[model samples]
Target: MHFQVWLQSIQANGRLKVPESEDVWSLLPSFPLSSFSLSSLSLSSPYLLGIGALASLTVYWLVTRPRPMRPPCDLQAQSVAVEGNPSCRRSALLKDDALLEFYYEDTRTVYDIFKRGLRIAGSGPCLGFRKPGQPYQWIPYTEVAAQAQMLGSGLLAKGCQPNPEQFVGIFAQNRPEWVIAELACYTYSMAVVPLYDTLGLEAMVHIFNLAEISLVFCDREEKASSLMDNKVKGAVPTLSCLVLFGDFSGDLLERGKECGVEVLKLQELMDLGRQNLKDPVPPQPQDLAVVCFTSGTTGKPKGAMITHGNIASNTSSVIKILEGSFVIQQEDVSISYLPLAHMFERMIQVSMFCHGARVGFYQGDISLLMDDIKTLKPTFFPVVPRILNRIYDKILGSVTSPLRRTLLHYAVRRKQAELSSGVVRNNSLWDKLVFNRIQASLGGNLRFILTASAPISPVVLSFLRATLGCLIFEGYGQTECTAGCTFSMPGDWTAGHVGAPLPCTVVKLVDIPEMNYYAKNGEGEICIRGHSVFRGYLRDAERTAEALDSDGWLHSGDVGQWLPNGTLRIIDRKKHIFKLSQGEYIAPEKIENIYMRCFPILQVFVHGDSLQSYLIGIVVPDPEVFADWAKERGFVGSLEELCQNPDVKKAVLEDMRAVGKEAGLKSFEQVRDLYLHPEMFSVANGLLTPTLKSRRVDIRRVFQEQISSMYSKSAP
Candidate 1:
């Protein structure tokens, strides 16, 4: 018999009989027990009838039935979505008047852009950091949005009312929990105040006192426990809640309870929201969304009250400048590794979401960035100078053999030649042989990179561009201006200069007295005015009035000048300029730039004024570069010896002189003295700010004795 007819003959009721051959069973259609019952009953045996009747009943019961019901609602059902928001659209995010006229004439609402991100990143792989010691896990955005809503509802259910200006503190690192907390606040119309994770106990107390944070979402047990174990002198006395993101099997919760605080895990909070609440009220565009802290480089740190309008406006500006620069589309991916407390990464996050790009957070240990990047293969990246320097160090480290070294040098020259000839694509055999490996080491699909914070070395910039066969767009901005001010265009790039101001920005150069290195006529401190300019520092009217003057021009405190072609070259910080005893004004950044080119150090901060005719610097040595140097020289001991050795200092000083001669700098401006520290100066050490800018006051105070001893001869 044919396979279909044979299978029908064996059908016992609504199910098929066991076939003798596996292959034959695969080819047969599903069997019905009713057919089998009819066939068997006609087959002349009462014994056969009994077996067939039992099989038919079993098939009928199994095929169509419902399981027992337990409760009125499933706990999992709280994560459901009520779709179709008319207020949220991608077009509403674009608010720059000039940019709207130029590119993106259509506008998108904040909610619309967020929903688009939801649609674009739907069910895709995304990694996020929760805290230290905890593994960074991957989850879909659809799940993240659901969890965020549930958490928002939970906050409302816990007697936390979301007023238009209600402030909640997000005191954590660049983790997925931080993002969720911020989004949850937006859903509930509560403004999130992002505090730096590296802040000390004093700064934390001060900020809590100022912002009046009733509740805080922190990353680990340490931060949460610290807040609860002790009484802060001037902190928010009514602060009663601490929600930890990860495993809190320590004394943190008990300590919190002792201080009249309620401690809970992030998961517990979300479960509560899901169980008690149905839906959350989303924030409007005009709502006070976030309060970002400005870098206190010149004075005390102040909260910059940012509305949704501000965020939407800045993200729109970013979209305008980056429209055709790179190939990021709705399908591309980006990796965010920088701290979210800073405005730079936060703005990039919003922009990436609006662009319908998937974002993956880097593993907490940034030393493993290469592994993470290789895994994610992001198309969009924004990195600081320190990261780029490491990349340069890695590439140079691979050149060991003579033949390999020569081949690498030859490839670089050829790549530069192709770039000069307007051939940016790496389509040649030599490029494949040499540069392709280099690109692969950076996860291979890197289309564009944005570098900011501290200035990047030109060699690093050129090497990245030629090797990646992609663009590296350099941008300049500050927290006061909400992250981005001006960026280099794809076709218009000039090294050492951070391109022209943005389309909406009006930049003017106010000529000051001639400095040692700045141009006598053309250069001056750069002043900017635009919509992106912040309202004022929160609650400090005097300082705010000083920063934003009578004419609405925000004094950027950065010295720069516009070239005849309209390109702006930032010289240095205005506060960094100091006059020597001989009355020669010197910009320390100019001296440091020359010194960095001379030494293999990560950074050089120059300081000298009243005492000496020249400059001195506190140098932070690169560990990898020095380690290889020590290995090559047969020197042994520790990394500290390599940094603080007199021989290393002499060699570095010789290179400094050579660099001074090459740059044609005056003798007085050359670095006359240097003190090498074994430790790296970072934001964690209170030396550098979160954005990588040098905290001049703190650094100067820390190295005062060393600096005084170095310049004692000239003090008289």
Candidate 2:
């Protein structure tokens, strides 16, 4: 049979349903060409057999092909420190013996970024937040600077010492007051320690005592009351004073007094500062700025001592990357919704300040994040992967009409084609007719959006690019490396890999012998060395030695592969892998990522340990999808009732298995049993980290019985 005849026959039989695109060659293997009957084809047995062999060879070649390792033209590689693989890489933007410490300002510390913002954008809108029935309110840079100075003075008057070891805690969400207190610590030589709710009361007490934190800035009265109660219980001995950011009742103050903790309203502290003003004492380069505790995704939270130089250099790297493509400006605004307690969001906010840009706070509501984004109408959005995932799922679920779905699919293809061809703008016909609504949801002025914290799927990234009508860049970093080591540059069109290392750092991968990942093969554990590396964990020399080497390389526990284009692709975890009873080493995150794509699954926790031969998943079902599923199946029940239905559980498990199979998960990797969790895995539930990454330790604790039962049921 002719080639055209075979192709047409396969197409006619519904075996070839891929969209026509430049990436068709890459998409061809995804279709089930094996289903094409050889008996009906006019070919000899040898010819048919050769066709199968050729197809297999082609697919293998495509799968194993090397990814690009060098950045685009003009940005060439300088050197490779590892043999056989160019595992060691730095941006050509950074020449030998060169680093970006201060790009926009002569900044030696975090306090300097604030000072620079005041110098360049004194009266510009700096920090902003919205009120009910009112537009966003703004605090100018000068006013913010003044408040920070006042707060710094007030702390000194309250007998807090001015030194890097003197930790001042801020236990609050993202707010102007949070920044003010943080900056206030930076103004002096004092270091800031952010407390997260994810780190429960025990961890909080541990951090407070470990760092000897005497005063904590609290935004909520309940938070203050909890701290006082803990203090009264003799859990936290160092607690001496409490400063409230918002309104507080007199009863809480009396309760604080009884606990021997001084309670002062935010304004009272600022007023106290008016009587005892002191000159700003900026920290030295190596002095600690923020002692960011890890969100405890794996185990106990460790305080990563982020120095002034670490953050200052990271901010410069961002500024340097955006200089030629999309420069940071005073008009550029970002909505700070992610936890400021984490290094990633804090880094983003600090970068905005260095550029004299505006930052608007969310209304402390995750559901209303997009509303805040729309209200602020930010020009650039910094977000996390889970948020984008929800948006992706929501957009897909909302496109229920068959005609509109088809159009949406084609529009995505056309826009993706345009994006790949180096055309990115919001005025295309596809944008006006198809994606305008999605764009409008993000305030309609976004020129680009950057997502970090976790890996976002390539499909979702492309969809965001096409629909958002803006550049979408993925960044990779950890709290250990001051939040960002590599960022997908502004011009790179393809996804999957987080782009090349930022100019501030040099990145290399070391061999993980047991995992079969080697630097010689262009894949291993990512290691970073430069000014941005943290200044060791607070009072934990043993773990700090493990994290940072004598040569100053920070060993990031994430496994990465170097692309041919110099971008880094996160492949697996250097930690978090569990060996099964059958000797299969399972990366639960890889399997979880696959199951998370299912329509009915909002979040999935895949668990398998040395004792279990097979995997079991605890799935948080999408509420809307779960209800729709029950309604379609003629069931009448609440979410909790539906979760207990055997048929519903079986259906969801099948869906997960199908998704895993489609994603090419190995047999051992595929989950055998599933428990439909009616409630989402959230920080409040003690099942997830603040950043939304699953706390495996916590999940295992919460579902210990369910997990054991699943293993028993799955035993053949």
TM-score of each: 0.80, 0.87
lDDT of 1 by residue, 497-573 (tens): 77656654555556565653333455767666665667777777987887888987778878876554445667666
lDDT by residue (tens digit), candidate 2, 120-172: 79799999998754689999998998998899999999998888878999999
For candidate 1, what is the total of clashing residue pairs?
17
Mark the regions of model 1 whose C-alpha exceeds 4 Å error after superposition.
1-112, 123-137, 230-234, 276-280, 284-286, 295-299, 325-327, 514-521, 627-639, 642-647, 713-716
Model 1 residue 342 CA deviation (Å) reads 0.3
Overall local distance difference test of candidate 1: 0.68
* lDDT to native, each model: 0.68, 0.83
Where in model 2 is the C-alpha error above 4 Å? 1-85, 97-99, 626-642
- Which is the leading candidate under lDDT? 2
